[model samples]
Target: MGYYQIDCFKIHLTILRILGVWPTENPSPCYIYLSGLFVFIFTVLYVVIYTMNFYFLPQQLEIFAEELIFYFTNVGALSKALAFIFLRDKVKKMLEMLESDMFQSDNPEEIKLIQKAKEKSSFYWKITAGLSVSANTVNVFLPFVVHVVFNVKLEFPVCRYSFIPEQYEAIFLYPAYLYQSIGITSHMLYNVNIDTFLLGVMFLAMAQLDILDRKLRKVTDVCVHTNAPSGSIDKMIDDENAVAEIIKCIKHYDAVSEYCKLIQEAFSEILFVLFSSGSCKICMCLFRFTMPAETKYFVFLTLYTVVMTLQVMVPCWFGSRLIEKSSQITFSVYDCDWTPRCRRFKSNLRLLVERANRPITIRGGKMFLLSLATFTAIMNSSYSFFTLLRHMQSR
Candidate 1:
């Protein structure tokens, strides 16, 4: 027999036979009638119990939202912190490069500062890397605990079974619970993927920053010394004024700043896309519409909490990225050897210096984007709240 057929036979012949309901032939008309009646009664009981419980005891649903909000917020914070730590070395090296030209490019002090910054950023980056994987795992699993709690409430009654006088309530009660339980579990899984994606992107950012910083450092190290290309050395411009030297060496630093900003902007854009897509929208709609009034209110409250958290989070994140990008520019310029004959080179370097300054503008752009996103989120929240209120009033 096929597996499904064998499973059906086993359930009917063994379990149903033991209970004395196994059919030897087609069920009689009386048996079919009774079965239909029982199913109908069970359906009625299920609907009544589910509707009553949902409309009355919204606290149960509120508890689930509260747990989810807490878990997700903490995960976001920890992931961000760990990501910062993992990129620390790159940040330090970039900073050193920016300050490299503060003294004579050929000076040992300038090289030493660069070296120290690289070492510091590297150590922190390693430490943060170790923490990020663990934090991500925790973020993925934390919501399962809440899922289990909701599932239990769905399956088990808070009151005594005897208190429910209807036979249908006893028969169909758990299935209604199963539906919401499944929804809760699905949402938790979705949250896990979101956290994992964020962490994965952060890991990539850390790795790319390391590679970029290493390349820039090598180039800066070469520029730190006074040896010009021979044979055509006379063709090369040289100058002593720090500003002129700065203008000359700005190109390489500008490249570093641009590369870093490019990575950050790309990552942010991906995050926004991921959060606003189809599945998130559908899930959010169900979460709002399926719950009763008080539960819906609590959902709005949770949204408010997320808003406040994001307000703090977005600004801090933008500030850190801005400062880091600016530091990379500073270190790149600092690595240049500003000498008396480098005047023409300095003029060519002006373009690069200007490029290095571009990240500050990019940083400002991010702040503007974040402000727009925040406004959108607020508008959505207000619309949802008012619509829900109108729904209640009409009812």
Candidate 2:
């Protein structure tokens, strides 16, 4: 049971709950009520601020550019929130399936394979989580630090709108700052948790593929050496056992296939939104970085660009690995000693090869394939946009 445990994902869920993006598993009445109330309040404030920024902000290029960045930041948050709220049940079901499949194995070899996969997955999750937290912390607190050190009064408006009344500015300033801070941070957490969880699932899929690859090779070896045994009876028994092992491998492969499909279904839209917003964010951040700006904002923009780039890269990296691992299944089947297997076993092998040839991929909204190639394309497009913006700014 201890070996079957998945603790890293649990820690992620805890962070989600703490950030108010996810409700408890069995929330009490008061907890549910308060959580609902808070979400509603947060949503309302977010909409008001977003609407104000979009419609009422001045036409100055610098202000408008800053507002656009803010708009997309909130857009990322809102999309993440909506995805979690709508897709949480699907995500939960996926997790349940993952846990059941990954932890139920009793074979020592299989267990070791599973443990290795889990370790790799945990490493990826921790690194991504740490980077996300560090980025958010700096982005959130840099203004205050700059204000203190430079002796400049920093205006921390959720969105820059011209509507705040002078008479109420003094009274509402602190409260407004507090409200915006909470709203933004919660939204940021939603982004972090959803992405991290999605990555966790991807990593697990990779682990499953690794195990499947090993099992596949072992089955092939057993089949290939069927003639090594001296007696006819021994050969027959070995053949029977090899067939059974192949059947088991087929079932394992099927389970992994289904798990990959579930992940695709659950996170496709979320990944789509992330890619779309991320591209825009990168372009804008890069543009802002190239323009003349204060030291504080320049640093913020640089960090923002890095964070956005990582957000896109994480999925692409994992998704590409998934594709690579899955594609190996066909080759693993071919590498086995299939020459000695019976008709039925060969038939199953052929089917496995056919299926594996199709390649398991994580698509963004079922549109763009999430792969290293896609990541490269995104980077190229962002740079192109940045170049175009620079040209216009120069003019």
Candidate 3:
């Protein structure tokens, strides 16, 4: 019986693998899945939230905005505090090293210092990497929690009678609202996490730059002062076999920094979009309470189109600019002077630049997908809203 049970287990494992039910070795595929989920959630949330603000308590939009602000601010503070505790010492050391004299050779003493700095920097960023993972995990689960907790409802009866009201068609809206609220909340939280991760990545690149700059300055000083044999710096510089490596490192630093800046710009732009949307929601609420129902829905539809378009188009626009910058960098590197000794280095630099400029196919590709999703969701939701309003009008 035991032998049979073991054989059954092996069979089950084989079946799972054959069916592609086993966990993937690569995490990129996993992240791509998450990103898809994220985009879907955001689209749904925009529809739900905007519709609720328009169709329901349009006057309470300001209050909702305030609540959102509090939630995002708290999350940001928590993430920043966690990052500081993990990275304080490493950040201080990197800053100190950057401030120090640049002619430090790869002597035993300098090597020890670089090793320590690198270790500390790595430790700090590892914390951020963990937080990035954690934040998304929390976002994934929070919607389920909120759905259970809020028991949010969007449908309430409006008086349908001319003399005495009859029940108009009941539209169930709370589930949609719940999903929207959760999606927006998750997005805000995710932005905070992205900002923290960008900071950590930038610091890591800075640490690498500091170490390399110090080593290069030391080599230049030595070459000036002493008639050293060829490949002298190769012995002294850690992994300094060719100029290609240095260019590669520099290119990597540029990539990291550029990504960080893009995140920053994207964050700010998204926030502006959210703020404007929120404000419009508040205005719609005020108008609805005081104005007619039909008029309120009209304004809501207009605002929805504007907000959704901005969200989709702004990112696509920025991503296009990034592709342009990356392309320019390719030519910039190719134009650099190459010494005979730096031939391998030049080739490597060219390779790095080419990779950076390769049209940003994968990451930038998502923008188009995002645009499609946004457009479809907005058009569909608007149609549904208008259809319902028309039905109410006919009755």
Candidate 4:
């Protein structure tokens, strides 16, 4: 629980467990069954409701745009669940890495850096979760509130269906409403938790790299080593402590690299869904903004667009930071008192720098690098799509 010790991640894992995607270590058969069933419900809901709705709905851009806002929930939820199950081996390795001793730190500075990273990751997920909850709340309750206050007929969240006979329509409408609400809410959390977990992994890797950079500098830091041999400063690199510390730094950096590769493997397909579907979701969300609508829908769109943007932005952010942290490792090795160190130490450091020179890169579907530039590109594509849709709507 090295990283799970943080409360945010603790809560995140708990919610994930409830959603059935993360069954925990050596879960009971009952737990697995229940989890599987819970996940299945959303998959079924997506197949039954969204597809049916799409098939039956008119070919109007405005109607499709309105419906698209909710489309991400079920598909994303099911895809993430499948990703976890399909890549359970990778997920297991990730859990092992998260709990491994390499991530543990006794130094206050290193611990602080780790904590700060977790805190930032926590803020990102929490905001996303909160927005998702808020949006769903408005959608579910708006009908009841309007019905009671304004004597208006209660309407379902999205496309109303003929699931019940006309005579029983009034009786079954409320139940249908509750059912859809549950599906959407569960799906929303499912998507949010997976995202938070992935972003958390990236931030954690960056923190470990930063810690390694700090250690690399201190390994050759001669001024701090009072026991340096007299009259030969470069010989300080020959000290056993310096040798041991450098070896530790090497192992630590290697562990971080391994952790990153496994993470990229586990989430490659899921990230593809997130970025590709996420861009269209954002584009439609913005496009939804231009249409005339009720205040509640407008509010939901505002928050949904923010969540969509964050879904794309946060990954690119953590991805870029990960690249930067790894890239700067070489500088960290050279910026220290390494100029006075011996040749063997310099050679070992050079190997480490060479490895660092490649840097860690996490991509979406192995197609686009997850960096801010990529994020900007996705946003530009989205804006262009929005522009195209707006033109169609005007005609």
Candidate 5:
């Protein structure tokens, strides 16, 4: 398959384009205007408007938590969307690298590995997108259902534009609510799409590593004549053909390393915001417990907490796997029949092993390493914040 067939992400990238955040070198005026509109919506409406609303709200834990959840969630989406826009050139380079021959292979086994990784990525995209859109649909429409069927007062699924005097809320509620539904739906899709796309890149990178390991294991394989002496096995340890194969594998490893470096460069800020803000988001999610025990909002918050946790945890998990898989290449080389190999091959292999000795670490924004330990630290910080909030409430 071509570069592990990562073109499967084309559809999602197109979605981002429609969402007006996809970067273009010279977008048409219409597209530029569309992009500007989203920028205004995210900055002026969500972040700026919501923050002002939060500040004016009374110091109740429920109000702050509710507003904070939406605000923080919006921040995640906005930051990632903006990062993608500004880092467009880096993203283009990364995609070019992904599609380069360095990540491609003719071997059936390696092709299968690529296929599996692509399938897994597509599966995640479906699940995450479906869940995200479904959750947003419920948030927007469920309130209207309550108003219609049970005569409960209607509410906006987002900030109520506290700047608008409540006396006239009735006049604007319908149109304002319409804007909320559309804006939030767009934001939700962007959130899931960008996240899955990032993680999918990492997943595919790990798959390349898997193929690299397998190639290393077979790097010394050689064919021998049936009449050849058993002693000839030593000479065949690394034939010229085997040397060529090992070189290709070495290049594959290098490509994967470079691919990861590009990912780090493109997503450094995005990952930083994810891990750093994850705790506060989780803390706000936890504050849902402060709501009435029988409240349905509790269930929503519970699910939201899970989504946020997965958002942080999945990156760390993939990152740890990337480090593990890349590091194991050295051992794979050792496992092959390389002891009696030629001097040139041995020297090259030795250099590769030396480089692999230091496991490739994908740091989150040049800060914490993206591993389970980092995930745990983030969760701990979230719990600490939650605990501190509880104590404050008790006082």
Candidate 6:
């Protein structure tokens, strides 16, 4: 799992280097100096170009609307880049803690569970990365394809910017295309990297909850005896072992709780920004889809909308799983044969049940819980915004 994570991080760094925004694990004086200069130049160019297209362009409503969607999308990507830069230490700490806390158990069942989690996480990461790359490739090449097939010259660059002088258009046309291609690809990769990394973290939390559930069930099974021997000596020894097992389970549960807290702290801000921007992106994409556009443009919008929906759904799905698994602990305790246990043992069980009753949750900036419910709310809000936009345009 560590190797896989490192490989993914390397891919992220490669993309950043291509964008001239390299972020090394160990920052030397030279690295810092160079990285700062690169980030400043890249960010300034991105913001100025997109901002001009969005706010200053003298274009039709349809054209401006399309540029607005791209503007917000790029803003989201920039937000991710800024977050990666500022929260590098926190992200590093979270990854270290995840490695140390999980995969430490010697129990065969626990080890198996962890392995399954790693496999699942890797699968998800690969699928998302593939989809992002494919979509970006299509977006980059579609303009050229349309231009060639239809033999119609585009009035503006593919991204519809207004800052370039008309006198320089012939000279800078191909150069501008190359620049936009690199800029758009970098934005897509950066956004996907941060989003999928957060998803991996959420999956880790879900895996920890799974381990805790299994451990609790096993402890309950071992400690709860349906039948007892008549001799006091034998029963006393049995009770002592049961108590020891329960104590061990208690420690394991505590560890899982602490791990969940660490995850929440590490990702709350990122999640908040993702969910917030994701809502607007979805709404805008849907609105653009409704508006009459070129065939290729419509296809791109459709794919973009699907990706945005998936981004929101993946986290909510894992978050909902976390809640379900955490809640199961109390029920597992209840399933144990607690009728014949001693008074002290029952009291301990009761306390464990109480603790487990508090369902674990992942929050967005400490604001709202991330769950299927939240996903539903985002969809509803997006539809409402889309309706309002349509009505205003009609008027």
Q: Which residue ranges in model 1 land beyond 4 Å of their true spot?
A: 1-173, 199-203, 206-220, 223-319, 340-348, 360-395
Question: Which candidate tops lDDT?
Answer: 5
**What order do you get sorting by TM-score, best first?**
5, 2, 4, 6, 1, 3
Using all chains and alpha carbons, the TM-scores for the candidates as numbered come to: 0.37, 0.89, 0.32, 0.88, 0.92, 0.86
How many collisions between residues are there in candidate 2? 0
Residue runs of model 2 more than 4 Å from their true location after superposition: 2-5, 101-103, 138-152, 220-233, 387-395
Worst 10 residues of 3 by lDDT: 156-165
lDDT of 3 by residue, 1-395 (tens): 12211121233223222222222345377654664455444534343334344333335433343233223333333333333333434433433333333323346655564455445444544564465446444534454566568964322111111221235323324444345445444444443333333333334333344444343333223223133455667433422444534564565545444533443333333333333343333333333333244765556445544543443444444334434544454554443333333345555665665555554311322232222344354445445544554555459
Q: Identify the runs in model 3 with alpha carbons over 4 angstroms from their true place.
A: 1-247, 250-293, 339-341, 363-395
Residues 85-144, candidate 2: write the lDDT tens digits.
677787777777777753357667766776776676677767766776676566557766
- Candidate 4, residues 53-166, lDDT tens digits: the string is 776666766787877766765566678878877787897787677678878888899989888888988987888788777867877777778988998988777555634557
Ranking by lDDT: 5, 4, 2, 6, 3, 1
Note the Cα lDDT for every prediction shown: 0.39, 0.75, 0.40, 0.78, 0.81, 0.72
lDDT of 2: 0.75
- RMSD, each candidate, Å? 18.4, 3.0, 16.1, 3.1, 2.7, 3.5
Quote the positional error of residue 276 for candidate 5 in Å.
1.7
Question: Pairing residues by index, what is the TM-score of model 3?
Answer: 0.32
lDDT tens digits, residue span 1-395, model 1: 12211121232133222222233346678765664453233333433444354333334543443333333333333233233234434433432333343211343544454344344444433443344334433433343455566653333312222234466774756553444333223233323332333333233333333333443344333343245564343324323333443433344344444444543553353343323331233233335445566764566556544544443344335435544655475355445443333445555555555654544422222433333344455446545754664576469
